[model samples]
Target: MTEFSSILSTSNIRGAYKSSQELTTSPVAPEPQGTGESFADVLRNAAQSTVETTRQAEAVAQQGLTGKVGAQQVVEATLELESTVKVMISMRDKVVEAYQEIIRMPI
Candidate 1:
C-alpha cells in the first residue's frame, strides 16, 4: 500500500491487490524504494514525547500547588513521573550492564 512499485511490480499486475486476502504479510512494510527514517528519527520522537510528558507533569504540580488542581491531579502527575523515571532508569541500567558485560568479554 505504501508504494505502487512494491505492491504491483513494475513488470506486471494481475488484479486489485487486497492487503487482507494475501496468503502472508511482509514483516517489513514496503516503502517508496528510497525514503527511510533513521534511528535518530525514532530517538527524536521518543525525546519529544518525554519532553511533553515532563511538561504536563510540571503543569499538574504547579496547578496543584496553586490550588487550581485537585489532590488527584497531583498524585497522578507524581505517579506518572515516578513510572516514567523508573522505566528510563531501568533501560539505562540494562544498556550500561550490557556494555560492561560486552567489554569484559574477548572479541
Candidate 2:
C-alpha cells in the first residue's frame, strides 16, 4: 500500500509524461486559474463521487457482515462513507441557495 500511495500521489502522477502507448491520462482536466465555475458542475461531481464511495462502502460492509472480511475494515469503510455523505449534504445546501438567488434576480 505504501508503494501504491507513493505512485498515486498528485505530484508523482503529474511528474511523468504520458507515453505514446498509454490509453488514458490524467483523471481530471486542467482547471484554469482564477476562473469561476458553474455551481451545477460542482454539484454534479460531488454527487457522482459520493455515490461511488457509498457503493464501495456497502461492498466492504457486505464482506465483513458475511464473515468474509475483518471488522476493522468495515469500520474504516463506514467512516469514509459517512464523510462522503456529509460532503454531499453541504454541496446540496449550497446549490439550493444558488438556485434561490437566481430565482430572486430581477429582470
Candidate 3:
C-alpha cells in the first residue's frame, strides 16, 4: 500500500490534469512532444497494476484454502487489495470532481 501511495500521489494526478488543461486552453503554446506517455497511459497502467494485485490476492487466498500458504499471507494480500481498491476509488472521485469543475466553467 505504501508503494502504491508513493506511485499515485494526489499531487501527481493534479499536475497531469493541469498540464493537459493548459495544453487544451492555450492556442499559442507549442504542443507537448511525445515522451512515450500520456495521462491515459498512466491511468491504464495504474488500473492494470490494480487488477494484477487483485489476482495475486486471489491466488494467495486459494493457496491458504489449500493449506499451501499461511493465513497471515492471505490476510496481508487481502489488505493490500483493499487498499489498492480504495486508492483507485479515490482517484476516480478526484477525476470526476475535476470534470464537473471544468463543466461548471463559463464559456
Candidate 4:
C-alpha cells in the first residue's frame, strides 16, 4: 500500500508539471486577419452613402415640386437624409475627439 501510494503521488505531480509547461509554452491569441475592409474604406463608403441619400432627397423634392411625386415620398427621403447627416456628424465628432486624445498623450 505504501509503494502504490508513492507511485500515485509521483504520477500526479508529473501530470501537474506537464500541464504547467504546456500552459507556459502555448501560442498566444492569433493576430486578427486582414479579411475585412479598412477604416478608410468604411469611412469612404459612409460618405458615399450620405451623398447618395442627399441626392435622393433632392431628386424627390424636385419631383414633388414638378407635381410628379407625392408628399409622402418627399417626407421619407428628407427624413432619411436628416438621419444620415446626423450620423455623419456624430462620427466626425467622435473621430475628432479621438484625435485630440491621441495628441494629448505623453510622448
Candidate 5:
C-alpha cells in the first residue's frame, strides 16, 4: 500500500480523459514522451500485482496447512494481500468519484 501511494504521489494519471478545450484548441502543444505507461496500463499492472499477491498468500496458507510454511510468513502474506485489496478498493472509489465529478461539469 505504501508502495502504491508513493507511485501515485510521484505520477499523474495520463490519457485518462481529455477535456473539450484540450481536443478543440488550435496550435496545441505536442505531448512530451516519457515512460509511456498509460493510465490503463498502470491499472492493469496494479491489478496483476494484486492477483499475484493473492495467489502467493493462498499458496502460503496451503503450505502452512501442510506444516511447510511458518505461521509468521503466512500471517505476513495475508496482511499484505489485505492491504493490496484495500488500496485497490480505495482507488476504484476515487476513479468513480472522478467520473461523477466530470459528469457534473457544465457542458
Candidate 6:
C-alpha cells in the first residue's frame, strides 16, 4: 500500500501532477513538463495499464487455483484490478460529460 502510493506519487500520472484548482480553472489542462505526451497519449497509456492489471489479476487467480499463490494474494490483485476498472470508468464518464458540455455550447 505504501509502496503503491509512493509509486503513484513519483509517476507522471495525470491528476497527481496538478491541483484541482489548476485543472478546473484552466480552459486547457497544462501538460506536465518534460513528458511531452499529449492528453490522448496519456489516455492510451492508462487504458493499456488497465488491461495489464486485469491480465495480472487473472494470472494471480490462476496461480491460486494451482496453489502457487495464496488466496490473499489473489484477493489483493482482484481488488487492485477492481479499483483500476472503477477509475477507468470514472475517467470515461468525465470525458463523455465534457463532450456533452461541448456539444451544448453555443458557437
Local accuracy of candidate 5 as per-residue lDDT tens digits, 1-107: 34544333222223111211222233345446774555677677767867877898899999999999987667666666676677778778878999999999999
By the lDDT metric, which is better: model 3 or model 4? Answer: 3
Tens digit of per-residue lDDT, candidate 3, span 1-107: 34644545476456445433432332355557864456787677778877887898899999999999987677667766776777678778878999999999999
Better of 4 and 5 by TM-score: 4
Number of the top TM-score candidate: 4
Candidate whose lDDT is highest: 3
Where does candidate 6 have its weakest 10-residue lDDT segment? 17-26
lDDT of 4 at 79: 60
C-alpha lDDT (0 to 100) for residue 55 of candidate 2: 95
Clashes in model 5: which pairs?
none
Candidate 4 ranges with C-alpha deviation above 4 Å: 1-31
lDDT of 1 by residue, 6-107 (tens): 533322222112211121222376566457655445445545655666788899999999999987667666655655555456545866898899999987
What is the alpha-carbon lDDT of model 5 when measured against the actual structure? 0.63
Extract clashing residue pairs from model 2. Answer: none
lDDT of 2 by residue, 39-74 (tens): 455556656766777898899999998999987667
Clashes of 6: 0
Shift in Å, residue 30, candidate 5: 11
Could you tell me how far off, in angstroms, the CA of residue 49 lies in candidate 4 after the best superposition? 0.4
Instruction: Give the alpha-carbon lDDT of every model.
Output: 0.56, 0.61, 0.70, 0.67, 0.63, 0.68
Native-to-model Cα distance after best TM-score fit, residue 42 in candidate 1, in Å:
5.0
How many backbone clashes can be found in candidate 4? 0
Worst 10-residue lDDT window, candidate 1? 15-24
Clashing pairs for predicted structure model 1, backbone only: none
Candidate 4 lDDT, tens digit per residue, 1-107?
A: 34534333454445444533432232355537775555677677777877877898899999999999987667666665666777778778888999999999999
TM-score for each candidate, following the candidate numbering: 0.56, 0.60, 0.68, 0.70, 0.67, 0.69
Off by over 4 Å in 1: 1-45
* Model 4 whole-model lDDT (C-alpha atoms): 0.67
